[model samples]
Target: MSFRARTTAVLAAVTALALGGAFAAVLVAFNGLQQRQLDASLLAVARTEAVEVHQHALRFSDRPGPAANDIGPLTKFGIIYEDSGTVIAATYPFERTPPHLADIRHPNAQPFNFLFEREHMRGVFMPIPQHANTFLFLATSREDFEGDKEYLFRAMLAAVVVAVGWASLIAYWMSGRLTRDHRNIAAVARGVARGDLTARTDVSSPDPEIVQLGSDMNDMVERLAELVSSQQRFIAHAAHELRSPLTALYGELQQALRKERDAAAYRQAIQQALEATRRLKLLANDLLTLARTKQDAGESPEAITLERMVEDARKLVADLATSREVALDIRLPKATVSHRHGDVTRLFRNLLENAIMHSPSGGVVRVESEHHGSMLHTWIIDQGPGIDEEDQERIFEPFFRAPNAAKTRDGSGLGLGIAREIARGYGGDVQLDTSSRAPGARFLVVLPAS
Candidate 1:
């Protein structure tokens, strides 16, 4: 069933059950009250007639037929002698034989009581205390009581149906409001699934939780859109970067192959091709490392000393520093950290290489590390032209080469970006601290200290 219909049905059923129970209780109590009143009225009539006989205002012998004086609503069935069970005075002539005394017997008969039900009539047989030998018999039709109960039942049934119908209508309206809100949210989600990232469940309701849920869903979609856009931008930039070296390598090889040349000329052409191939290989490796660091799974972290990592990075960049005619001044502490050995090694190697490439001849590329509380802070300071403030923020973007570095340096810009990615993978970060140094760039790496 639809939500509205189900809600209406449940509400109606519950209301009906509640109303039915309450009405049934009222009917039962009212019926009992009516019966009590009937019983009291019968007793009162019996008492008054008995009192009149005792006061000499009535006589059984004089009133042997229908009563000449009214004795209230109950019809008198005449006075009887208890010992003989014979009618002495009757309000009307006996049309049918009376019940046998033994059949009317009550084991513990009270003063105003006997078993007297016949022909759809019910009454009581009462004995006069003043006249020990005499008893009164009176009865009335049960048609009036039955008729009142039937009328009450019909009225209650009508009231119940009206009440349930009204309640059902209200329930249906409320359910519609709730389901409409849900439908709006579902529509927004469907739009998002169809790649419409701008779609949102901008719903307003009295319900706080539903409103909060819609807000959270909108936030999630916005974040997902941002991530997908960033991925696309990265792919475009990577393609542009890879095409440069590939085109160079392809052109050099094509020229060498066409129109055979002297050995000296071929050797020079092969060397240039090898140089392009090496640059392409380096770019490809950096791209692969960055992609791996972005993935959700890889090698688990292990305990490795920061000092040993610095040593490894220094050795890896020794050739580059020597070629650049730069001095490496290493100052590292004996601190251990929990990190993937290969990732940390590559991260430090990239930073050292970048520093060495940027430094002028005879300039010092200083490496320093320290343990501070729960973090290991490392600094790689290069005596090169400092990064401009405008480019600091975008310095770590993949394949984003700074203007100065692009003009003077012979290296891809992915080194610093890959270094930052690897550092962040270990719950650490790498950033340029321009304010902390002058006439050079200072790159800081912070990792968890074990």
Candidate 2:
């Protein structure tokens, strides 16, 4: 699900939980308060009835018609009396006249309060002080108690319903605001992915986290756009550079082959054509290697022994060095240094070939390998005219030939660029070291040890 929907769902669930807990607590507290009030009212009624009975007991001998005055204004009271037995009475007479005062007498009769019927009622029984053979019973019906409780229950239920409705509305409003921000972020991300790197999310909230997220996303888009533009420019420049050499080679060959020529002229033309073909092949290979290195940089690395790779590179370039009359000096440590083999080898071959190609006749080209900590370092130093300090940094850029080297030989100048790309692919890098003690260029390759 989308982030906005998920966030809304989580918020809604939390709101429901909070509302349920609050509503239940309110209901419980309301019911408890009502019950306490009902008990207090019942106790007040019982006390009033007890006082009336006590007064009537004091006048028992003086009264003529009945033991008590016409049941007092507290007439809704249900009553029971016990002398020889039990008798029930009420202000309002019943058709059966209730049991007389002989049915409930017992040795264990005691005064107590209890609830009776659906209505909560309180009952009390006490012996008359002056009337030796009489006891008075009084009870108050809880109809008022029930009526108040019913009203309270209805009020509480209405409040809960209203509270829930309000909570839902608030939740909806908050979730809508959150969802809108989430949608804006998602839309911006989608646009960026579709190559619209200028797209950015609107930051409406003053929340720090959201504002930071928007800033970070915009920064990432800007960086991506720059990288894409740089890559396009590089590709266009590389194509132009390659086309120039190919066009020159094609024109030279066509012109050389157009007329009948002496053997020496034909031989020279063929040699020039072969040199052009070599340059083209070298350019194509460097470009392909650079592309492959970039792709492989994002892949899982494999183990390769530095010593073995250096040995292989030396063997591959041995013939070229011999043909050029350049002396090869290979020095590898006895212990095995492991790394990403393919990239390491590519870096080694490029640096070695660059040194050999640039070195003057009879010049020595040295290849050395060593290990330090978690890194493998390789150095290729040629005893040719060394690069200037200012040009060392830019030497690895594609098609960037140093002034002296360009004058000395027709070098394509992509070898160092391709070498550095491979070096970087293996979590390593290559750079020209102008501080070399010898009077030639020193290219250092540092790779992560496996």
Candidate 3:
């Protein structure tokens, strides 16, 4: 599902739960209030009846020949009287009356007011106040309280149903407002995935989080556009560079075969052709390595022993060093220092070759390795003319040639660029040290130790 739809669904569910809980709470509270009101009404009826009974007893105490004549209309209450420790009057008719003096001695045993149920009647009790040995009990039927409770419950249930419907409507409307941005973001993301690089999500609100998301996506697209454009330019430049050498070699080979020439002249022409072919071959190999590195970009990375890899790489370049009469010095710890292996050999090879190619004949090219905390530091120092301090930063850029070095040496100017690329791929970096102590040039390689 789309982001907007999912967000709406989750919000709706939450709203439903909140509204359901609220409805239940309100219903329970309303029922409790109703019950309290019903109890109060019952108590009021009991109090009114008690007063009437007390007045009647005071009026009939002197002329009580038969208690039934003094009794008045009891209304909804059932009345009973105890006189001389015997049942004197009762509003309820019974074939055999209950004994009154059985448990009347304990005044605290039953309070003056209490709920009572006898046969079908159910209500509260209120003792009549009189000096004579008499008691009055007044009660009404249970149906009155029960009917009130039923009505309150029905009304509460209806209110809860109505509340749920109204709450659901409000929740859906609010959910739409909240998820509107999410919908726009999703639509823009789809467009971007479908090759619309210019597509961008709208951030109409002032919310920081939403604004940040939109800004980040736009920044990513811009970066991607720049990268694609650079790649296109690099391919065109590389193609032209490759074609020039090939064209030169082809022309030289064609001229050599056109006619017979002196041995020295023929040798010179063949040597020039061979040199052109060799440069073309080197360019092709460099391009291939770069392409392979890019292809294997996101594979699993593991700790590689830098010391061992460096030693192996030096051994590979040993023949080249001997050809130039250059000495190699390797300084590394005994403990195994490690980093990612991917493109690490390339990084070392490029730096070592660049040093060797620039060094004077018989000059010593030093290869040193050491560990500094979490980083494995290695440097290739040459005894050639060091780059100027101002030009050090631009040396690693692709095809960037330093004026001093450009005058002294013939190079494609891609070695340092390739070395830096390799270093970056392995989570490391390459830098040129322009200090005075070892002033020829120091290509420092730093890789994270495992």
Candidate 4:
């Protein structure tokens, strides 16, 4: 069943059962109470008859006469018996049984109640106080009691039916209202799946958990939209950047093969073509590294020593440093960080490469590490002219080159961007430290220590 229907049915069933139980109890209690009150009235009537019988006996010279004169018999049968177990008078022409007389004469006999074994009859025996061995026996038909009980049963059943019907209606209404927000969320998700990124659930509910859930779902959709837009822009920029080198190589090859030339001329053309191809290869490798950095977000962390990582990165850029006549000053301590080894290695290598490329001849590129709380901080400082104020913030953006540094450097601008992306993927980050006390650019990388 639908949720609404099931909810309503469950509520109705519970209500019906509860009400039915209560009604049954009430009916039983009422029947008992009514029967007790009827017995009381019967006993009272019997007592009044015995008193009148005593008065009549006194008037008739100590011999009992008719016990009741004007009052009609309310019981089906009424009898007045003497101390010798003789029936003096009776409303109905019925003989008293032997057991009835024995019960009256019993020593411990008080007011007595019994059901006749052979017949559907119940009666009470009330003893007379001022008359010796005198007793009154009275019984009413059981049909009256049964009729009243049936009437109560029918009335209670009707009330239960009405109550359950009303309860079911209210439960259905309330359940539908409660699930309306869920329906709205589903509609929004369907719209999103159909490429409508702008669709959103604007529902507000009184339930705090539901409200929080809706908020989280909306936030997820918004993040997905942002990611999709970013991927599109990235693709466009990658194509434009990649085409530049490919076009230059294509033009050089066409010119070189247009006519016959000397061996030296052909050798120069091949060299130019090789340079273009080399640049293209570097760009392709950087793009792949960037993609991998994004894809390896949940890689398990391994124990890697920060000192060793920095040393390895320094060696990778050793050739460039030597060519620039730069000095690599490394002062690292024995600190270990918990991160994927490949990600940390790539991040550190890119940072060192950026430092080496920016440093002038005879300049010193310093690599240092420090332990700060749970984080290991590595600072790469170059003694070249520090970054200009305008390019410090945007330098870490992918494919973004500093206008001043771009003029002299022949490297792709994706090194720092890839480094930061990898650092962030491992729950750490790399940032350009603008507050460097030295006369060079300082990049700080922070990673969790094991």
All predictions: root-mean-square deviation over Cα? 6.2, 8.9, 11.4, 8.0
Per-residue alpha-carbon lDDT of candidate 3 for residues 256-301, written as tens digits (9 for 90 to 100) = 9999999998999999999999988888877776666545554366
| Model 4 bad stretches (over 4 Å) | 28-154, 176-208, 254-265, 291-311, 318-345, 356-365, 382-397, 401-413, 421-427, 435-440, 448-450
Clashes of each: 1, 5, 0, 0
lDDT of 2 by residue, 304-332 (tens): 56678888888888998898999988887
Which residues of candidate 1, in runs, are more than 4 Å off? 1-9, 39-144, 165-190, 201-215, 249-273, 294-304, 359-363, 383-391, 408-413, 434-439
Whole-model lDDT, model 2: 0.67
Minimal lDDT window, size 10, model 1: 61-70
Q: Which structure among the candidates has the greatest lDDT?
A: 1
Q: For each candidate, what is the lDDT? A: 0.77, 0.67, 0.65, 0.76
Model 3, runs deviating above 4 Å? 1-204, 260-266, 294-312, 315-329, 337-345, 358-364, 382-398, 407-413, 421-427, 432-441, 448-450
lDDT of 4 by residue, 240-344 (tens): 788888898998899999999999999998998899899999989998888888785545878878877777777788898898888999998999888777678
Q: Looking at model 3, which ten-residue stretch has the lowest summed lDDT?
A: 61-70
Best-matching candidate per TM-score: 1
Write down the TM-score of every candidate. 0.70, 0.54, 0.50, 0.62
Residue 196 miss distance in model 2 (angstroms)? 4.2
In candidate 4, which residue pairs clash? none
Model 2: residues with Cα > 4 Å off, grouped in runs: 1-188, 196-230, 249-275, 291-346, 356-364, 369-376, 383-394, 402-412, 421-429, 434-440, 447-450
